[model samples]
Target chain A: MLDAVILTGLTLGAIVLGLLFIMALLSPLEALTWWAGWTSHAPSPGKLSEEVREEIEAQADRRREVGARPRFYLVYLTAIGGVSAEELSYRERVFLETLTEALPEAVIISDVYPFSVTNNPLTGERMLGWLWRKIHEKRKTITGGILATFIFARNLFNVAVSADPRYGPINNAGVAREIAKSLYRHDYPLAGDIPVVIMGWSGGGQIAVGVAPFLCLGLDAPIYVVSIGGVLTDDPGIAFVEHLWHLQGDKDHFHLISDILFPGRWPFIKNSAWNRFKRAGKMTVITPGPMSHTGKGDYFDSNAILPNGQTFVERTVEIIRDAVRTIQPPPPTSIEEELEELLGRGA
Target chain B: MLNNSLRSLMAISPELQHALLVLFLAILSLLFGNSVVLFANRVSRSQFIRSLLAFAFLFLLTFLFWTLSVQALSAMVFGVHKPFVDVFIIVSQSFTPFILGFLILLPHLGHYLYALLRVWVVINLIIHVAHAYDFGSAQALVVSLLGWLLLELATSLSFLKLDAVKRWFLKIATGKAEYRDPNDLVMAYVRAQRALMLQAAQQQEGRDA
Candidate 1:
């Protein structure tokens, strides 16, 4: 009877412990509950309280006095072919949409048509009429499988080029020049000294590198250009970065592996992210911690964040909050230390 | 005589110098620990294991404390283990989807390279979690959380500050807000679409001409 009593006690204890352990694991997950907890806390004083939410509504009230809102636009280029516009991910769309949403006083510019001479029948007519048609016809003789493979290879090549600054900047010069002209017009109130952030994902990033030099040519403002997945290079760094922000997601395997398969100045941005943000006495290279090259972040449960469906509009609202944030990078390390830091044993 | 000879021997070998240098570094690490390890670019393997141990210990301690706290208390008591566990699970799970998705996409990768990447993601996730956890005092935590939200707001503002494209986005977003007659937005969007199509066609014709 004593032995039976001990076994029952042990079984009851085990059941209690397991339930406690599992509950412990699951509670932080009730994100809505945590959010409710946050709301219960008193509102923090000052600009933070004003800047994060309902204050954006009040921001429009001052817009008339703020006058012509300074404008910035990114002319994005997706891969030459392959992934449809609809196939692009939420974050990818967010990168573009958030900025466009921002200009209470400006416009966001983009072209959906593929800049290909073949395959994009709508936009292809002029260029395909002469060169691509004959070339494609001849190539078609080599079998559809070869054609399909070529298309895939070409699409991959655009993504690769987009990641590197060297070959990409020149891929679409006319578009870059036009986009630059529109954003740089002198009429905007924030003109002359306002900040403009231009970014591109994939092919758009490549053109950004090229666009930088043109921006340098026309403007003398304290402009900040941040390119997320694009490659920009060739012209001297001084010509481009009055201040530049580059955000690369370390988790994204596509860019990480592409660096090995085809490499470039990507290491400059990638390595900086790895090391402490450089600062010189009072000045710093890029901002640090929460403010970074990567856009505003999303938790895994970002889907469950708010009202109803996890649609593009809800995410876009979140994305807007992500993009406008900034922090001055930690003061950069001494130059000698930085060089030794980046270069290592060599020199 | 043995003591005198040992003193003389200690002065003779370069190998002894190398050994002493290594010993000094190890002692330094035990003293400064990870602050020294931070000198490395990514977390070193030793540092990684150490952080894991730190996390595991903190986790165990927090759980034990919470369990102890809740045990004798009424059923209304809450356990404190949830935050750390969620942190650990998030760190582990976030990487898997991307890596697994990529693996399915690129199956032939060598095991060693894949393992290296897996380790890299784990370390980064740890950094992210720790940054979130360490805000100073309760007063400080209150301030920093607000700062985090401000940073969020500022970023959103930066996007809103863009040019022509912003208008289009506002239209789309406001259109979805649906207080309006739904047909107005659709009609506007359709007209814009038509205008863009016509413009592209015209540009193509001009080029052909």
Candidate 2:
């Protein structure tokens, strides 16, 4: 009887021990996943799996059907004193990389600094860096908020010149001359028409828009320019902005915050004018959440129209492709048109 | 499959382990899941989640005291049943040596605040073992001997052993390797909290100029 009692005690003890072991392992403290990253997509997405594959395949087919396999050159522009946009997180990096794969070649990176074989004659350090530094420092010094009224007034004066039909394009002509001087050491050099994607972040955007005369002049063919987290002064004309797309994060108050604090063309910029104009085009503006300008990952995740977790990467590709396509006005075959056609009143 | 394994791993804990699990869950849920609690202070949701998890895991394993008064209660109030006695002995024995093991491993994980508790547990175990040896206690001898041997073996394998872990060590040494959030919620939380202040400072500078 004593032996039986001892055995029962040991068995109960072991059961309790097992229970304790299980409980201890479940401790709430260890669930943190810091050294982790976002996954692209699981191997399967369940019942609608075929649909997803079909859609992806159809998109690829469309790209091929359009003569030249369309290229998506996303030149990510960065802020003043910023590092290469390549530092984008694994998730954002994957998006850009994947987008590049679908195109003819991967995105050709052009840093606001001298990131390319694009040669310059004047300073020899590459005017990209020369122009980039001046603007960034200016933004750094410019006052934020209403206190920047003096700078704002100076912006108005500059805007007047750009806005003027008489001298604006003329000044652009002078800019073209300077660019020619810089490129050829005396005269404008010939540049073949390869599509250009000019990306800028913060003050880099200012330079990207301002220096349009340099890039657009003497171009042999239509070029596509894209801006992200940037500000544009005016309609850089139908030529530069015809196929232009601007991206900004919704929660990214960086651009918005900059506008609120130093609204006009302070830091030598007057991009607020273009904001309204571009809005008219109804282009995609992604919204992640209420904006903060912390980083590109935030910018990627931020969407005005897109829900928080949706892919801005794919949507960006489609917008660029649409912009570069043949421009045709929408046909008047709306619901109203259908009724009219039924009544034989179609225009 | 991985999710199932993690869930099962997390679920199979005793009361103390359960507490650590709760801390982990709370951290992830509050920071990543709800996010309401994170922004309450300078700390972010991620940081809050991490710190609480560390607190829960570290606290339960090292700090809770076993007293003479408790032993007296076990003997008198509940009639000091054999099963209860056995459970008390196993739980207490299991915890002490593991706590010592954690202390041995803590320094390698980097200088988080929880490392202090880890060292504390090790020192306590060493002292207990020595006391056990002086009194010729068999349980103390076994636990201390096993704990010390395991500690020595782990250290040697990590350091002296080359081919097996060289790649991992190199990555870690250069900070190329990522570690699960080692209670770094404090820094992340603090950084997020400071964003508004920087904005305000910029504004103030603008006004002053």
Candidate 3:
């Protein structure tokens, strides 16, 4: 009887352990954290709050009075876990603030998308309710562990298929659409034609490239991309951008593995469509030595001596300023000129 | 040892040779581990034929791991896709080069010949993998290197441990038992080889004197 009882207990324990293992494998916490990190730069007090928005508008109006073109700099912050830019940790906020201060001419606007749904000041039950609604609207069933396993497997299969711009879970298209809508929205007024520059850091670089084609089509202006230690798959849509500057540190081992994971980025591989687009001068790759994957250490310090005398940050800033200055606006075309040219060709 | 055994078997009668072949197959099946054959026999409710077939299939599958590793590494790294069974067949057939392992019975020169055959087998493996997976020369070279690393790890973990197990059995049978750790046995073998080489050199010097 004792043996039988022990055997039964062991069997039950094994079943419980198996179930727990499956539950742990299918937990959404990791995916949630990654998404949260990706969209942590969502516009905060400056864009979301009414007082800050009015103050920015007043500043822009004053700048416009000085005959300056209303230049909008939309910077995508590097990965950090926060609902919005307002809630970003002290260090992250300071970094973005410093960047904004450096670009004194342009009106700086920044936001995180697709994950902006998580941008709420509330806590506990309110956040849970918000998450529940978002999941419910997406028609995702997360009640049981078995269903979660199926969802996870499906995501794995999708990643294996391409890891392209159409990766479903991230909803790159939806994010692009949302950004386009925000840019066109009447509330945030801008004078004259808006010259917008889109920039992202780390994983945000992939998001920037994914959204560039959409921004180019919607905004009717040139789009420039700056990717720093970013993981990006070769997508033909990147051709729509005026120029893409990929700045990577030579010591960045993590960034190098991105090429292995996403084979489209491998330069030597032939017969890839992305490689053709890359060879067309649309993409410029710069490997600045003595730089870490995270632009930290000697790379981040302004006084740090480099082989080229200039510090890493100084070189990076110079490259970015040069890229911005080299943006040539599209020449105007009139209907009369077009008709005359066509008539002359026919003659 | 395999060549000597085969030569001795050839001097026997025809009927004895047939029986010996069956016994050899049976022993081979046992050496491969009877668990798979027993499982097959239990599940199928068949005679010895099912077990024999299962043994053959399992033996072939071992070689298939080499091809699968190459294919998987290529697919993951270069996004090259190929049929699994096609690779398996080519890899299994490429095992012909390893038949030179029997040459180990040819005394001192046998070891050199066997080492050469191993390199030939690796070349055959690389060719087969490249053909089956439709990889370019450079990609195939990378796949072969990675496949070799995978095969070496698998071999050390599984097959190489059998030598230590055999040594343990011999030690017990001879009653010359020494408490030797299995992990340290590799170093012991290296030391033995060095001693043998030194003895050979001293003998050569004495002969000259």
Highest-scoring model, TM-score: 3
Candidate ranking under lDDT, highest first, comes to 3, 2, 1
Each model's RMSD to truth, in Å?
27.7, 28.2, 27.3
Tens digit of per-residue lDDT, candidate 2, span A1-347: 99999999999779756644333322111111111111111111112223322333343334334444123233443443342343333444554555455454324443223111111211234324454334433544543222233223322233232223222332233232223223322111122233445555444454445445434433222334555555444434423443555666565555564444333424345354455435556334444334334444444432423454445555555444455443332222222323233235211
| Residue-level lDDT for A299 in candidate 2 | 43
Candidate 3 lDDT tens digits, B1-209: 99998898798766555534543443353323222212211222242344445445544455556667866887899987666655555555555555444333221233355567667867776786678677777777788778767766865786568447544643444332233331133223222322332233334335546
Segments of candidate 1 deviating more than 4 angstroms:
A1-67, A71-99, A102-106, A112-122, A129-173, A181-193, A221-223, A226-239, A243-251, A261-321, A325-347, B1-209
| CAPRI class of candidate 3 | incorrect
Model 3 misplaced regions, further than 4 Å: A1-67, A80-83, A89-95, A113-165, A168-170, A181-193, A268-273, A298-312, A332-347, B1-209
Which model is ahead, 2 or 3, in terms of TM-score? 3
lDDT of 2 by residue, B1-209 (tens): 99998787677546535544443443333223222122222233455555445434433422232323223333454344234333333334434423222222111111232355445544554454335234234444444345345434655675666424533642433322223231233223222222322233234335546
Interface RMSD of each: 24.0, 28.0, 37.2
Report iRMS (Å) of candidate 2: 28.0
